[model samples]
Target: KLVVAVQGTRKQHVDTVGPKVDRQKKSPVCSYNEWDPLDEVIVGRPDNACVPSLTPEVKAISSPQQWEFFRKFGGQFFPQEHLKKAVSQIEEMCNVLRHEGVTVRRPDIVDWSKAYETPDFKSKGMYAAMPRDILIVIGEEIIEAPMAWRSRFFEYRAYRSLMKEYFQAGAKWTTAPKPLMSDELYDQNYPVESVEHRYKLSSEGRYVTTEFEPCFDAADFMRCGKDIFAQQSQVTNLFGIEWMARHLGPDYKIHLLQFKDPNAMHIDGTFNVVGPGLVIVNPARPCLQSEMFKKAGWKLVEAPKPMVPDDHPLWMTSKWLSMNVLMLDEQRVMVCKHETPTIKMFESLGIKAIPVDIRFANSIGGGFHCWTTDVRRRGVLESYF
Candidate 1:
């Protein structure tokens, strides 16, 4: 049985769709939906499914040493309010899975309390898998690349925890090692060419996809982006991306996005084939041409446009990062609210679109799709006449 569990903000829902609300104000939350259609066919493990042995178990001990350890590590990265809310939701999601007979587990502070209590707690935060705490369909292993300062501390850790947990659940996981950049460029810290996204295996897992070459410089990024100070490299870093891809699965296909004429923001930003012959891409900024999508037996749909020119009032208000989508099937997808128009347009073509609420994180640059990666997908079974 396929299941999907969602975390929603319903009170905000009414305000977003209210007739009097500003289109721009409501735009960010417009696609929010509690029940997504993709769940009917593709299970959302992070939201529901659980693995038993992979679950974290805690025991109470009278020893002061143990008590001290628990007190120290029990809550590190999050403030009380945030931690409470996060834990509650995680528990609820787990319970839902338990009700459905799925084995599930959550990471705990039992073994690493001492490591977490230090000032370097932030570095050790990798163990916790903060904001994106749970790992699902991808298996018991966690995977990640470098991120910004604030995000690096806890979010990366959360990503790792999920990856580790996924591997524990019997799924393969992998990633590209951090590249060694020149010191002169180190202060700028922008990658000229690299894999921006990756895929881990799940169920008959066979292939992996990543962003193409012709690396972007500051000019390719938003004008307001800090990395705008650098230059782009023509040579592609296909090997680094290929390294991670091959480590995780068998066969590989590089879905290279054409540069020069832009359309999609990044690889994950658009060009998701949720179902065979059903593709979601930004007609303006695409990984490849519409012909590619059509040739792959995919039906194309334009993705949401990103608002840029950082200084603009609406810049932050508009959705720019297209990386926030999860594929439920080749035809069905779970997308962020900002992608509502894209979803509606897709449904117009007889494609089923399911929206997931992720407004808070949308402000942070990524949405639900960016937060999670599907490790497993149902294989296309060709029927004989």
Candidate 2:
């Protein structure tokens, strides 16, 4: 007969064979904001990354000039030579993190070229190279996002091992309800020809993603202690933001921010909250709610123009990635080696810049903030706004 210990009327099971457990043990996942002292983080991999198909969602966010690249290379690996350089650059980044005394973990490398079919749609996988787009750490819990892209539906599989480890170590794990990427979930007639038209539509809250089901990319959200700033983008709908608000309960306040971007997708590149009261605002894509931050006594600094050459291929993003930096702590920032103006800006703010060259990696769609998710940061929950 198996011996089981039950507590009260709830019928909670106590492990009889294992050592005595401490119920008050702190969870291994505890990151309230972006600038906390870094402890452990999950860095993404560039292995076997595949280009997503040129679907409506992709078309909505991409510039008109980059469509040809997507049309030619969709459903295939990014140029092998480019990927090779990205891999080397990422390895150096991991090394830099290790040198900083931070524990770095990586996702399992899976073949993203494999195709799969669901009841709603069929598509191949994209890279597991951006952990920040799929996983969010809010206090002691790790929430897996239900990404909007069809190519990203199964991206969570690469992070399951890490999730299990964190859960075993006493972390609360939650996966938001996944959205079915059916025809109804997307606007089949979303205007993609003109940037001006897209800007008008985005301002009116008409995005490529419909409200058929809650869908969001984790990158669309910027966490700041008790308050979280979110955006309704081509990949993040109003319904998704509402779902997150309700799911997080009244303890956390979710602020919906709008910007002047025509191809808005991720907020990190546009309005990254680097500290409790400091934010790096993109000059090109100005936030409409700038006055709110100002009234709250927050300093919104405009980012200097990016130095990425016009010939460089940024397939899925713009040059504003220069602003998407990761904060190791309130005093240190991981920034692009080539972005000299950004480095100077960080220095002017009294933040040390740990420059790493990820120019090739940036081609895939992210920067330091997008490539890694801070798993355990030394901080507590507090209201900054």
Candidate 3:
């Protein structure tokens, strides 16, 4: 008879316990790539989202026209009225997900206005509004990225509860080595005054982030089964991509892709892989390796111009958020309700577009794809490239 302790009390003896079942069968996290049949996901919250200070890293990615907004609102909560509408919009998005036969989970809401300091740097927090920037699910493991921004260093706290629950349920959880985010990690004198100058620098493989330490945003990577695509951008460096490549090991292949954009940060807004061999390429920032995808028999579709009015405030990101769509499955996608061109483009591809309005949420710096991270999708690992 086998005995087991119960809460430090007397033990009970019973018949022999059976051998452990297959972990994969009991795993609550099992996504290998994008566009798999949907199962469960984690949607982010905007309750107490705060604007980040206008640091060097922030300035490198943001446009000059929007600098004034960050200068005025840094270290403060986003406009309350706008945030309220954003909250409502995101809630409706969650409802839409639930109705579509997919399970939706949310991160804990914390006061992002709190400030903290590490030996290397001191900064206040930013919102938990974009889970895709911090959490990535590859196979059975969920990776917490060592974010590049000082303001986002503690963002993982918002997702710890869910991560713990998933770990207890037999899922693997891995947090990459946290970066120090000290002054050495950034290029203090990155020229941002001239768009043409920035473009020349980016074309020459230069960016605002230096190689002091490995740093990357999870959004800089796009997963596709056995092959993963990565870009060295303002928030992601070559060192970080090398880290991910070595970490994944021989089972997967990582490709380094480049674009023509001057202020590249996240790849999803520029090169989004929607299906097994279909990709939506940004018209404004053409991919340099287009021939590679074309030769592989993959269909590369160019997204239409975004229709966001110039008067609307897009303080942190470009209008290309219209292309930053979330795929519920290969057959369905979540898109902005106002972006009729994007919706039409999806329709033309035989994919159904589930439109939801999150315009206010986009103002904070993310689209549907950025606001959520897929935890479980019904699929197996296969070579898509």
Instruction: Name the top lDDT candidate.
Output: 2
Order the numbered candidates by lDDT, best leading: 2, 3, 1
How do the candidates rank by TM-score, highest first?
A: 2, 3, 1
Q: How accurate locally is residue 28 in candidate 3, as Cα lDDT from 0 to 100? A: 92
Output the worst ten-in-a-row residue range by lDDT, candidate 2.
Answer: 1-10
Q: After superposition, how far is residue 233 of candidate 1 from its true place, in Å?
A: 10
Quote the lDDT for 201 in model 1: 15
- 142-171: candidate 1 lDDT, tens digit per residue: 334322221122333324454554444444
lDDT over C-alpha atoms for residue 306 of model 3: 96
What TM-score would you give candidate 2 relative to the actual structure? 0.95
- Pairs that collide in candidate 2 are none
Best by TM-score: 2
Worst 10 residues of 1 by lDDT: 222-231
Question: Per-residue lDDT for 1-385 in model 3, tens only?
Answer: 8876533368767575432335556689889888998899999998999999999999999988778888998989999999999999999999999999999999999998999999988899998999999998999899999889999999999999999888767788899889999999999999999999999999988899999888889999999999999999998988888888898899999999999999999999999999999999998999999999999999999999999999887778999999999999999999999999999999999999999999999999999999999999999999989
RMSD of 1: 18.8
Worst 10 residues of 3 by lDDT: 16-25
TM-score of each: 0.46, 0.95, 0.94
